[model samples]
Each structure stands twice: as C-alpha cells, then as structure tokens.
Target: MRLALAQLSIESAAVDDNVERAVSAIETAAEEGADCVALPEIFNVGYFAFESYERAAEPLGGETHRRIREAAIEHDVSVLAGTIVEDLAASADAGEAVPAESGLANTAVLFDADGKRRLVYRKHHLFGYDSAEAELLVPGDQLPTADLGGHTVGVTTCYDLRFPELYRRLVDDGATMVLVPSAWPYPRVEHWKLLPRARAVEDLLYVGAVNGSATFEDASLVGRSTVYDPWGTPLASSDDDATVVYADCDPDRVDEVREEFPALRDRR
Candidate 1:
C-alpha cells in the first residue's frame, strides 16, 4: 500500500484553517495514488495551543472527524485523522467508548476508504516537559490495531514514540505497520528521528512518523516527517516543509526482514 505522511502547517488555535489544510492534503495524497494518508498530531488545533484545548475539544464524531471521514470516502483512500483534543463527556454522550467519563483526551481516529471508523487510538503517553499537555489532556489507555488495505496498522502519537514497550505490545497484537502522528519541536529533532527509526528496526515493521510544520508562540515544530521500512531504511522524508511524504510499503516486507535478520525470534 502507498502511505502518505502529511506534513501540515498547524496554526495555533486555528481549527477551521488547519482542518481545511488537512482535507486538501488528503485530496492531494489520493491524487498521488496513496492508499492511506496520515496527518500530523493535532492538525486541527496546534499541539502547543494548550489554552485552546478545551475550546477546541470535540467528540469522536465531531465536525473535524466528520469532515475527515467524508474526505476518505470522497477520495477513495483511508485516512488516519492524526490527533485531536477530545471532549470525553461529549463522546460518551454520543455512545462512543471513552477512557474517561469527563475531561479531555488526545485522540486519533482511523477511517477506511468506505468511511468506516476502523480504529480509535488515544495517546497513551502525555508529554509534560515544559508544556501543559499533561495538565490539560487525559492520556489514552487502550492500545489497539486495525487491518486496512492489506496491512495490520497500529497507531501512536508524539510522546508515545518514546515507549518501545508499547510498540512491542502492538507487534504482539499482529501489527505490520505503525503510524505515529507527532508535533515534535525544535532542539529534539534527533530524538524525534531516532525514536521512530528505532521502533521500526526493533519491531521489523513500517513506521511512518508524521510531523507538522509551524511556529507557535512557545515552540516551533520540526517537520521531518518520515516513513521507515522494516530495515530502518528511510523510504521517504521531508525537511521541515509542509508537504506530503509518500512511500510504498508492503506488509510482506516485515516478515521478510524478520526472517532474514532472525532478530525478533531471539527476543526473550
């Protein structure tokens, strides 16, 4: 399948503009023959927009998700709607299973080409270092994977990349590819690049690290969105530009890499 990592320019608290940009990216990816397109973290609301988290929070099937779902159906491509600030109470009222009854959560949803809600992954790790993310949003608890376009896909967010054990769990659950929607910033460019590459190497799966491109009041995003193969080889990458990084990935590559290396079999 062809995967496109959308490196979007996220404006702080600019929900409408950002969502519009995301939709445009999806359309462009479909035009480029991408089977699936993944956006960066909090594409609607900038990740550094802490004060606007509450105001921008929406339910699972809120306007932002509805728009993304519709785009997927219209474009005939699957979409990973990056991450959004979710209103847990509203989601619960809408009959969606939420991690909490109230408060907010950083959530990512996957929509199939037919506009089916394939997977919902809330961020398991909430970043608190020099940010109000931990204080403002609730962390996700479930680690789920879904099958899409002949690949077993897993979802993770920015901070979740630091946790290798989580990736191992997904591998155990039969994941062949993992999409990491991130809003990584400057000064930590090495960390952002290294972690996802390491995850792909360790799990022997496709790792698509999607990041945003924008400068906020407190931080500036490092837009090195990349797609790594099972061999830790970068298939496609961008350099801090708002563009779509595309890579053709085959699920069988994961098995082939594992069989050739025979490293995962040695795991204790």
Candidate 2:
C-alpha cells in the first residue's frame, strides 16, 4: 500500500476555501498513485479558530462529508477525512442515537474508494495544555478500525498522539497502520516528531501523521507530516509546508519487523 499525507495550510474560518484545498490535495495524491490519502485535524475552520467551532460544526453526513465522498470516488483512493468538528446536537436532532452527551467532538471520517463511509472516530484524548479542546469537545468512548489498501487502519486525531494506550488498543483490534490526523502547532516539533516514531517502534505498526501547515492566530501549525515504519524508520517526511508526503507501505511489514526484533514478547 501507498499513503499520502496531506499537510494542508489551514487558515482560520475559511471553510469553503479549505475544503477546496483538501480536494485538490486529494487529487494530487491520487495522481501520485497513493492508495490512501489523509487530511489534518480541524482543517476547515483551523485549530486556532476556536470561536468558529460551534458555528462550523457539521453532522456526520454533512456537506463537508459529501464533498469528501465525491472526492474519494473521483480519485479512486481511500480517504481519511479527519478531525471535523462534529455537532452532536445535530446528530441527535437528526434522530440518531449518539452514545455521548449533547455537545461536540473532534471527529475523523474514513471513506473507501467506492465512497462508503467506513469509520467514524471521535478523538479520545483532547488537549488541555494551553488549549480549549478538553473543554469544548466530548471524549469518544470507542476506537474504530477499517480495512483499506491491504491494511487494517485505525484512526486518531491530533491530541490522541500523546496517548500510547490508544495506539496499543488499535493494534490489538487488528490495526496494522494507524492514521493520525493532527493540527499540531509550532514550538513542540520535537514532541511531534518523536511520539509517533516511538509509538511505531514500540507497537510494531505503521504510524502516519498528517498535520496542518498554515499559521493561525496565537498559534502556527508547523507541518512535519511524517510516516514511520514499525522499526521507527522515516519512510517519508516533509518540512513546514502545505504539500503531500508519500510513502510506500507494506501491511505485513509490522510482522516482519516484530518477528526479527522479538521485543514484543518481552512485554509484561
């Protein structure tokens, strides 16, 4: 399998424009022969645009999703359309029984090449350190995984990267590759770089992190969208920019690496 991480440059509150950018990025990735393409967290409204969360929030089957569904079909590539501000109220009003309280969630949506919605993962870990994420969003109770491009792919949002337990649970649930849709900002580049690599090395799964690239009010997203192999090797990476990073992946490489290292058997 081949993956393309769309490191988008997100501007605050530019919903329509950002969506167009995402579509363009997806098309580009498809042209590059990527089997799957993943976008960043809160990309439409921008992560720093806190005021727009409630207003910009969409239901599970909203226009944003429709556009993405179309894009996925048009490109013939699976898509991880992630970290959309999901309005729980809208879903509840639409007569669907949401498991969480009436609020919002930082959500990820996955679509196959046939334009079917495969997975919906609300971010389990919300960032509280100098951010309003924990206060603004409801934590998810479930971890979802999907089969795509010869890999069992699991989903997570930006802040979930700091939690290793989430990844471990995903692997236990049959995920050979984990997709992290992040809107990580500047000044924490080291943490951003090492955490996914560490998780990949420890868990014996491919870790793909896609981050936003643009600067927003009070915080600027430093784009270093990276993909790590099971042994913590950087397959593909990019500097701080709005571009697509591509990497060829082997779904069984995790087993190959783990079998050679034999470190997971030592786990207590």
Candidate 3:
C-alpha cells in the first residue's frame, strides 16, 4: 500500500490553523493516490505548548477527532491523526481529583477509509528531560494495533522510539508494520534517524516515522520523515521542509525476510 507521511509545520496552540493544514495535506495525499496518510505528533497543539494544554486539550470524540474523521471521509483514505493532547477530566476515577485541569496524553487515533474509528494508541513512554510531558501527561496502558489495507499496523508516538521492548511486543502481536508520529526537535536528529531504522531492522518489520516541521522555544524540528523496509533500507525520506514522503510497502516482504534470515526464530 502507498503511505503518505505528512510533514507539515505546526504553530504552537494554533488549533484551527493546524487542523486546516492537516486537512489540506490529507486532500493532497489522496490526490496523489495514497491509500493512507499519517500526520506528525501533537499536530494540533504543538508538543511544547505546556501552558496551552489545558485550553487546547479535547476529549476523544471532541472537535479535533471530528475534524479528522471528516477529512478522512472527504479524501476517501485512511488517516492516522497524529497525537493530540487528551483531556481525561470526565473519565477520572474516584479520588483522582480530576487532575486540577485534566492530565495530558499523547494520543494517536486511526480512522479507516469509511471514516470509522479503527484504533487509538496513547504514548507509552513520556519524555521528561527539558520537557513537562512526564509531569503533565498520563502514560498509555494499551498497545493498540489495526488492520490497514491488508497490513497489520501498529501505532506509537515520538518518545516511544527509544524503547525497543514496546516494538518487540507489537511484533509479537503480529504487527508487520509500525507507524510512529513524532515532533522531534533539532540537535537530536541523529537519534531520530537511527532509532526508527534500528527498530525496523530489529523487529523485521516496516517502520514509518512522520515528523513535524516547527520551532519550539529555541528548538526547531528535524523534518526528516522516513520509511524503512524490513531490510533496514530507507525506501523514502524527506528533507527539513513541509512535504509528504511516500513509500510503497509490501507486508509479504516481512515474512520473506524473517523466513530467510531466521533471526527472530532464535530469540530467547
């Protein structure tokens, strides 16, 4: 299937503008004959918009998700509406104090071709160094996967790239491909490039990293969205610009690589 990685610039706390940009990208991707498109992490409310979290956060079926669904239907293609800041106020359990304003969550939602909600994956590993994500957000419990056009796809967010165990579990659960939506900043471009390829090689699956092109504080995003095949070869990549990277991935290649190499068979 042909996948489009939408690497657009995000304005911190500019919800309407970001959503409009994402919708436009979806239309463009569809016109290019893409079967599915994935956006960058926290595309709505920029990743470092901590103070705006409470104001910008939305519920699962709120406006943000509704806009994404409408875009999917209009474009007639599946969409991985990248991570959003979730408001868990109403769902808070007893004695939880409602988290004062509501805790944030790096949540990714998937919509099928017919605009049905296919899956939702919250970010498992929250980044804390130089960011307030660890203090402001709640970690996800479920490792969600979905079937997208004959491909068993797994979903993960930016910071989760460093954790190989999570990808291993997804591979064990029959995921042939993984989609990572990221808002990775500058100065750590090496980590952003290497980690996803490493995961793809180690897991023997296709890996797609969709990143944003935005500046936060003094940090600018490294908009090198990339796709890696099972052999750890880059099939498609983008430079530091607002563009869509496309790749044609075959699920059978995963089986072929694993069968020929038998690396996974020797796992302890």
Candidate 4:
C-alpha cells in the first residue's frame, strides 16, 4: 500500500481554508497513486487555537467530515481525516456513540475509498502540560481498528504516542499499520521523532506520524511527517514544511519482521 502524509500548513481558526488544503492534498496524493492519505491533527482549527475550540466543534458527520468523505470517493483513495474538535452532545444527538454526552473531544475519523466511515478514534491521552487539552476535551474510551488496503489499520493522536501501551493494544487487536495524526510543537523535535520510531520498532508494524506545519502565538509545529517501517526504518520524511510525504508499505512486511525477530511472541 502507498501511504501519503499531508503535513499541512495550518492557520489558527481558519476552518474553511484549512479544510480546502486537506482536500487538495487528498487529490494530489491520489493522483500520485497513494492508497491512503493521512492529515495532521486539528487541521481545520489548528491545535494551539484553544479559544476557537467551542466555536469550531462539530458533530461526527459535520461539514468537515462531509467534505472529506466526498473527497475520498472522488479520488478513490482512503483518508484519515486527522483530528478535529468534536462536540460530544451534537454527536450523541446524531446517534453516534461518544465518550461523553457533553463537552468536546479531540477526535479523528477514517474513510475508505468508497466513502464509508471505517473508524472514529478520539484521543485517548490529552496533554496537560502547559496546555488546555485535558481541561477542554474528553479522552477516548475505546481503541478501534479497521481494514484498509490489505492492512489492519489503527488510529491515534499526537500525545498518544508517548504511551506505548496504546500501540500494544492495537497490536493485540491485529493492527498492522497505525496512523498518528499529530500537532506536535517545536522544542521537542527529538521526542516527536523518537516515540513513533520506538513504537514501530516495538510493535512490529508500520507507523505513519503526520504533523502540521505552522507557527502560532504560543507555539509552532515541528512538521517532519514520517513513515517508519516495521523494522524501524524511515521510509519517507520531511522537514518543517507544508508538503505531503509518501511511502510504499507492504502489509506482509509486518509479518515477516515479527517472524524473523520473534520479539512479540516472547512477550510476557
């Protein structure tokens, strides 16, 4: 499978413009023969735009998702719609299960080439250090996985990478590839790069770490969107720029790595 990571140029509170960029990236990735394209976290409202969260929050089937679903069908390529600020009450009103009936959540959705909603993963770990995420959003309660392009795919958000147990759970759930939609900031570029590489090495699966590119009032994103193979090799990566990183991944590679290493089989 060919994977594309859309390291978008995010602007704070610029919903329409950001969404437009995401759709364009999807089209470009499809044209380049990418089977799946993943966007960065909060690509619409920007992760550091805390004040705009309430105004930008929408239901599961909101306009952003509608546009993404349409794009997935038009391009005939699967898409990970990155993370968005979700209104839990509105989602419940729309008959979608949410972690809470009230308040907002940092959520990510996945769509197949046929425009089907395959997975919805709210961020399980909300950042609390010098941020408002923990106080503003509800943490996800479930880990969901779906099959896409001959790979069992899983979804996680930025801070979730710090927790290796989460990726282990996905591995137990039969996931071969995990897409992480992140809005990681500057000053911690080493952590941003190291965590995903470690996750891929330990889990024996493909790890696609997608990050945004923009500077906000308080912080700036460290782009470097990358795809790490099961053997912890960087297949493709980028600097802090607005671009799409592409890599070809084989689902069979995961099995081969695991069988040759036999590390997972010896887990206690």
Candidate 5:
C-alpha cells in the first residue's frame, strides 16, 4: 500500500490552523493515490505546549478528532491522526486514585477509509528529561495494533521510539509495520534517524516515522520524515521542510525477510 507521511508545522495552541493544514495534507495525499495518510505528533496543539494542555485537551471523540474523521471521510483515505491530549476518565466504581482535574494522555487516533474510528494508542513511554510530558501526562498501559489495508499495523508516538522492547512486542503480536508519529527536535537528529531504522532492522518490519516542522523555544523540530523497509533500507525520506513523504510498502516483504533470515527465532 502507498503511505503518505505529512510533515507539517504546528502553530502552538492554534488548533484551527493546525487542523486546516493537516486536512489539506491529507487531501493532497489522497489525490496522489495514497491509501493511508499519517500526520506528525501533536499536530492539533503543538507538542511541549504545557500550558495549553488544560485548554486544548479534548475527549476521545471531541472536536479535534472529529475534524480528522471528516477529513478522512472527505478524502476517502485512512488516517493516523497523529497525537492529541486526551482527558482521562475516572474509574468511578473502582474507587481507584483517579486524578483530579482530569488526567492527560498523549493519544493517537486512527480513522478508517469510511470514517470509522479503528484504533487508539496512548503513548506508553513518556519523556521525562526536563520536559512537560513526564510531569503532565499519564502513560498508557495497552499496546494497540490494527489492520490497515492488508497490513498489520502498530501505532506509537514520540519518545516511544527510544524503546525497542515496545516495537519487539508489537512485532511479536503480528505487526508487519509500525507507524510512529513524532515531534522530534533538533540536535538529536542522529537519534531520530538511527533509532527507527534500527527498530525496523531488529523487528524485521516496516517503520514509518512522521515528524513535525515547528520550532520551539529550546529547539526546532528536524522535519526528516522517513520510511524504512523490512530490510532496513530507506524507501523514502524528506528534508527539513513541511512536505509529504511517500512510500509504497508491501506487507508480504516482512514475512519474506523473516522466513529467509530466521533472525527472530534466535531471540531468547
């Protein structure tokens, strides 16, 4: 299937403008015959916009997600609506320690071609190094995967890319491809480039990483959206610009590589 990665800039706290840009990218991708389009992480509200979490956080099916659904339906293409801040619901009956003021989650929502919500993934590994994510968000417990146009797909967000165990588990769960939506900043461009390729090679699966183009106070995002095939070869990549990177990935290639190499069988 042909996948389009939309690497666009986000105006911090500018939800409407961001949504418009994302929708436009989706339409353009669909016009180019892409079966599925993926956006960068936190495209709705900029990543690291700590103060806007309370104001920008929305329910699972709220306005931000609704806009993404509309765009997917209009374009007749499946969409991975990057990441958004979710208002965590309470376990009222259990009497558990439900967070007051509503907990926050870094979430990614998937809309199928017919505009049906297919899957949702909350970021498992939260970044803590002098960042707001460590202090502000609640980590997710479940590792979610879905079927997208004959491909077994797993979803993850920024920071999760640093953890190979997560990708290994997804591959074990029959994920032939993984989609990572990120807001990776500058100065760590080497990590951004190497990690995804390493994951693809180690897991024997396809890896697609979409990153934002926005600049923050401390650092600017390195917009090098990239796709790696099962053999760890770069299928396509983008420069530091707001652009859509495309790649045609064959799901069967994963099986072929694993069968030929049998490297996964050596895992203890």
Candidate 6:
C-alpha cells in the first residue's frame, strides 16, 4: 500500500482554515496515487492552544470530519483524518461510552475510499507532562482497529508513542500496521524518532507516524512524519517542514519478518 503522511501547519485556533488546509493535502496525496493519507493530531486546532480545546470541541459527525469524508469520497482514497477535540457529553448522548466525569476526548476517525466511517479511535493516553491535557481530557477506554490498505490498521495519538503496552495490545489484536497521528513538540526529537521505530521492530509490524509541521508560541511541533517497515527500516521521512511523505508498504512484510525472526513468540 502507498501511504501518504500529511504534515500540516496548524493556525492556532483556526478550525475552518485548518480543515481546508487538510483537504488540500488529501487532494495532493490522492493525486500522487497514495492508497491512504493520514493527518496530524489536532490538525484543526493547535495542540498547544489548550484554551481553545473546549470551545472547539465538536460531536463525532461534525463539520471537520464531514469535510474530510467528502474529500475521501471525491478523491477515492482512504483517510485517517487526524484527530478532533471531541465533546464527551455529546458522545455519551450519542450512546457511545461516556467518561466517568464530563470532559473531552482526543478522537481520531478513519474514512474508507467510499467515504464511510471505519473506526473511531479515542486517544488512549493523554499527555500530562507540563501540559493540561490530562486534567482537561478523559483517556480512552476502547481500542479500535480498522481493515484497510490490505492490512489491519490501528490508530494511536501523540503521547501514546511512549507506551509500548498499548502497541502490544494492538499487535495481539492482529494489527499488521499502526498509524500514529501526533502533535509532537521540539526538544524531544530523539525520543520521538526512537519510540515509533522501536515499536515496529519489537512488534514486527509497520509503524506510520504523522506529526504536525510547525512550532507554536512557547511550544513547537517538530514535523518529521515517517514510515517504518516491519524490519524497522526507514522507508520515508520528512524534515521539520510542512510537506507530504509517502511510503510503499507491503502488508505481507510483517508476516515475513515475524516468521523469519519469531521474536514475539519468545515474549515472557
């Protein structure tokens, strides 16, 4: 499958403009013959703009995703439309799982080539270090996966990269590839580079990570969207600029690597 990672620039708190930007990126990826396009976390609202999270929070089928879904159908390409700041109460009223307390969710939704909703992945882990995400948002309880691009794809958000157990759970659930939509900041570039590749190498699966492309005031996003093979080799990567990165990944490669190495079988 040909994967296109959209490294987009987020204008702080500019939801509509960012959605338009994301659509342009999707169109570019489809024109390039990409099988799927993944956007960055909080692409519509800047991750550092914590104050806007509540105000910008929308329901699951809100306008942001509606626009993206339309693009997915028009372009005939699968889209992992990054993530949206979701209102948990709206989801609860919609009959989905509601948090114990009233709050928001960092939710990622997948749209198929036909513009159908495939999966709704709420970020399992919320960022807390030097940030208010943990206090402001509720962590996800469910782990959702999608069947797409000839692989079982699982979605995880930014800080979830630090936790391998989550990825291991995904592997156990027959995930052949994992796509991460992140809003990673600067000064932790080394950690950002190492973790995703490590997850792929250890699990013997493809790891596709897409991050935001610009730095915000006081906090900055380091754009290095990358794709890793099952063998942990870098297939494609972008620098700290807003651009698109693509990689051709074979779903069978994970099975090939796992059968050759059989390391996952030795786990205690």
- Per-residue lDDT tens digits for candidate 3, residues 174-242, read 999999999899889999999999999999999999999998875789999999999899999999899
Best by lDDT: 4
lDDT at 102 for candidate 1? 97
Q: After superposition, how far is residue 92 of candidate 5 from its true place, in Å?
A: 9.3
| Model 3: residues with Cα > 4 Å off, grouped in runs | 91-102
Alpha-carbon runs more than 4 Å astray in model 2: 95-97
For model 6, state the Cα shift of residue 187 in Å.
0.5
Better of 4 and 5 by TM-score: 4
Q: Encode model 2's per-residue lDDT on 159-205: one tens digit a residue.
A: 78788888888877988899999988889999899898998888898
TM-score of each: 0.99, 0.97, 0.95, 0.99, 0.95, 0.97
Give the Cα lDDT of each candidate.
0.95, 0.89, 0.89, 0.96, 0.88, 0.91
Flag the better candidate by lDDT, 1 or 4: 4
Q: Give the range where candidate 4 is weakest over 10 consecutive residues by summed lDDT.
A: 93-102
Encode model 6's per-residue lDDT on 183-229: one tens digit a residue: 99889999889999999999999999999987677788888999999
Query: Cα RMSD (Å) per model?
Result: 0.6, 1.1, 2.8, 0.5, 2.7, 1.1
Q: lDDT of model 2 at residue 114?
A: 94
Of candidates 6 and 3, the better by TM-score: 6
Model 1 lDDT at residue 197: 97
* Candidate 2: residue pairs that collide: none
Output the worst ten-in-a-row residue range by lDDT, candidate 3: 91-100
Q: After aligning candidate 2 to the native by TM-score, how far in Å is the CA of 177 from where it should be? A: 0.5
Clash pairs (backbone) in predicted model 6: none
